[model samples]
Target: MKFRFAMVCSSNQNRSMEAHFLLKRQGFDVSSYGTGTHVKLPGPSIREPNVYDFGTPYKQMFDELRRKDPELYKRNGILPMLKRNLSVKLAPQRWQDNAGDGSFDVVFTFEEKVFDMVIEDLHNRYQVLMKTVLVINLEVKDNHEEAAVGAKLTLDLCQKIEAAESWEESIDDIIVGFEKQHRRKLMYSISFY
Candidate 1:
């Protein structure tokens, strides 16, 4: 089976959306989803009850991207993965089970809160498998930096994974790298803050 990577971004609109497209562009099978449950069409989310409403212009941006970067998708091939299938459902109960489903070889959480929550749940339910999930705090200044950050992170991860002797060994190295970088960034942020 083709390797799968799931990226959970804070808001489904900008950062996560860009990450999804860029990964596909890079020839990796990736899927992205938002944190909150409620999804809307056309423009950002309205102030509807129980909705996260990230205000992502999914349709507009996607169309433009496809037109401008048609080769990015065409070269990759037809049906270049689907956003719907990769979109993860964030729920309390499914948290544990979802982490261990073996569907994803690697999982990344963009925000701190989601990282902490998902990491804890993954550890509790899948003690042995928890190491597979890498908690990355891509805490850049804003969404503008997300694309650059995501690309850099993906490159770093691919390097480590490629260097490893085996998939299992690479998985451990990737997680360690992610944690080390995350802590360093946190320290830098604390000093700046």
Candidate 2:
């Protein structure tokens, strides 16, 4: 059976979007969510900021892809196409509410806030069938770099998952590897902070 995975990230636009595409391209059954809401209004509200950078500017990214690969542009607008292929829904509710669903075979939180929130919610829900949620703290030099790093990380992780003797036996090992890598990065950052 295809592995069911949910990827939750702080912003729906950049890193998560890239990973969503890459993971599906690797043949996993994946879904994604962005924490920020994308609201469209006819006229600008006073509260609305015109130059809002949600995650990565998807339009600019897509335009870049258009220049690089015209065929890809014709095939699909990057965000919608990724969403369509991955069955990703931009969730309105916070991660806490999302955790109660008990639908995900594996939930991978891409940000620390979402990770803690999911853990709390899962503990409350106490769902017997739910698997451990994996936290993927993708390391990159800067925010703009997350998409590239996240895509590579996801691809590598997918390869490891596929090569495993069985998902049941090695899922924890996979998670441990990701967690260790993430923590090492965190500790590395502590020096700068």
What is the number of backbone collisions in each predicted candidate, taken in the order shown? Answer: 1, 0
Stretches of candidate 1 exceeding 4 Å from the true structure: 39-57, 60-100, 121-135, 167-193
Local distance difference test scores for all models:
0.47, 0.51
**lDDT score at residue 84, model 2, on the 0-100 scale:** 40
lDDT per residue for candidate 2 within 118-185, as digits (tens), equals 55555667556534444444443323356667666766776666677775677667767866875533
- The local lDDT score (0 to 100) that residue 139 gets in candidate 1 is 49
Model 1 weakest lDDT span, ten residues long: 184-193
Q: What does candidate 2 score on TM?
A: 0.55
Clashing pairs in 1: 44-55
